[model samples]
Target: MRPFKSVPKARRGDRVAVISPAFAAPAISPAIHEQALRRLSESTGLIPVEYPTTRQLGASAEARAADIEAAFADPGIRAVMATIGGDDQVTVIPHIDPSIIAANPKPFLGYSDNTNLHNLLWNLGVPSFYGGSTQIHLGAGPGVDDIHLRSLRAALLEGGSIELTQTSESEDFGIPWEDPRALTSFGNREATEAWEWAGPRKAVTARTWGGCIEVIDEIAMAGRMPPLADLEGVILLLESSEELPSALAVKRWLRSLGERGLLQAAAGVLVARPPVSELSAPVPSAGERAALRHEQRDAILGQMALYNPQAVVCVGVPFGHTRPQWIIPHGGSITLDGTSRTVIADYAG
Candidate 1:
């Protein structure tokens, strides 16, 4: 496994940067963004510092990268977080000065399109958390979910290992930000099923890599992916976005990874519970939703079987595009115990 560096934890009164490296979700919903800031400070006691382009929708890629660079270069800022994921972070990644982050390494919290940044940090040997979105997780819900808060604390203030538990219920998306209830109520939620496990019934613990598979595709096409050799014995984190791609689409993505020898290089794979319904699309029936998840799971397992049958695989752990998400480590350690049917994350301080 590559030696990724763990950044120092932030003190209660420290400052953390909140920037929009992708879509400026905060620009569209300032109320939610303000609420998220309040909750973040109240929960962790760390003040959030926003950059100039944080709320500037359609800010140029260079402008976004400038905020990121300034945040990392600032000694007072102990961590950097994204407001929400968007479609075009691939463009922003190139403008970032790698040396700024390399010199002043700090914890970064985000997922989805932020995967591009995570992969950059991983290559720079800096570790990051994979599931905190200030707008989606902290700002829009009734309150920050307990599981999310625990992992958030682990990644930022506190540092330790915590079991990744399944929440009794999960929601694919929250209510529209324009609705008043979006602040006080959760979107439609349903009972969750146990995570499905496959491959050998054994334990494999290693540092993690991989994120929103859609972003991974873009990174690969841009030639930003790490060498396949670096992934040897690492746990692969794979999750879909709110785009709700079909099962065949997911299969093709995974197949591409496998063909590039990524799947075979990993000791284990961890898949997130995907979102099946888009806010704009008609809601799916419960059975339809279940079938969609099952098809995705089967597609993932088939690819894993073909590439590395001995690798431990677990599907449907809530981490991406799901409410009550766990802000797990990106380049830090995670243990996949197929024998015990458990997942534990290491939040190194």
Candidate 2:
């Protein structure tokens, strides 16, 4: 596999493309989407540029891919961001030309189903961010989470290393976008527990890979996954989405990756705090939610123990499908120190 390279950061006042490669979330709630755009511009100083398919609901895969191509092809567009993640982005991957992104490499920020695009960029030897959804993080919330904004700046405007920290509070799902209070209020938040660490008490530093495990499954089935040899010595970032897969499901997914030698190839693994509830479903009780997280953590640890007990592992650092997210790198550097249990991410790539 080709080594990934860092993309140039955008300066204040530079233009950034806000494309909807997965779902046209903006079309569902234009009010929140517009507010997110304003907040993005205000918080980062980069102009938000939108493409035709950015807000077009039910856009064709080819059209979405073209918007992505145009965003990268334009030298003026310093970064590309997704509005929000949705199902079926896997179908859009075939339409994107890897060369276009490789030729004009730049920061691409997103998570969840956007993992498909991240994997595409990973294979093309380009680094991208693994979190940040304009509709989810910027628009629906009362304000941007502090850690999120800091990491966003690091990924786009500032080139620096930051030690990941807990926000003490987290939310599985926020209010519905249609609710007027969604813009001015936060969701039902609760205190969080400390991250759980396992494996050898050693530090592992390498360029990061992996994303939503569900998406990784799709990429693997599509035969788009990089060789296990390429993943050697890398820190794997694994997390689940709002679908709230059961612990058994997560175990099956990780076991599949392990069977494929992905687990054994990694130097370390960092699993995000998985979401336990969703807006469409009744909120689980506090104990039930904690139990869910624990079950998933144990499942991951069990699989890792069977596959690569030597690799350092940490679970429950908020990054994917959760609030107060830290937009860590996709194909960039991350240091997992098991002895000290610290996760320091280098946004400089």
The TM-score of predicted model 2 comes to 0.99
TM, every model: 0.99, 0.99
lDDT tens digits, residues 239-324, model 2? 99999999999999999999999999999999999999988878889999999999999999999999999999999999999998
What C-alpha RMSD separates each model from the true structure? 0.7, 0.8
- Tens digits of per-residue lDDT for model 1 on 1-349? 6677659999999999999999999999999999999999999999999999999999999999999999999999999999999999999999999999999999999999999999999999999999999999999978999999999999998999999999899999999999888999899999999999999999999989999999999999999999777888899999999999899999999999999999999999999999998899899999999999999999999999999999999999999889999999988999999999999999995
Which residue pairs clash in candidate 2? none
Candidate 1's displacement at residue 156, Å, is: 0.3
lDDT for model 1 comes to: 0.94
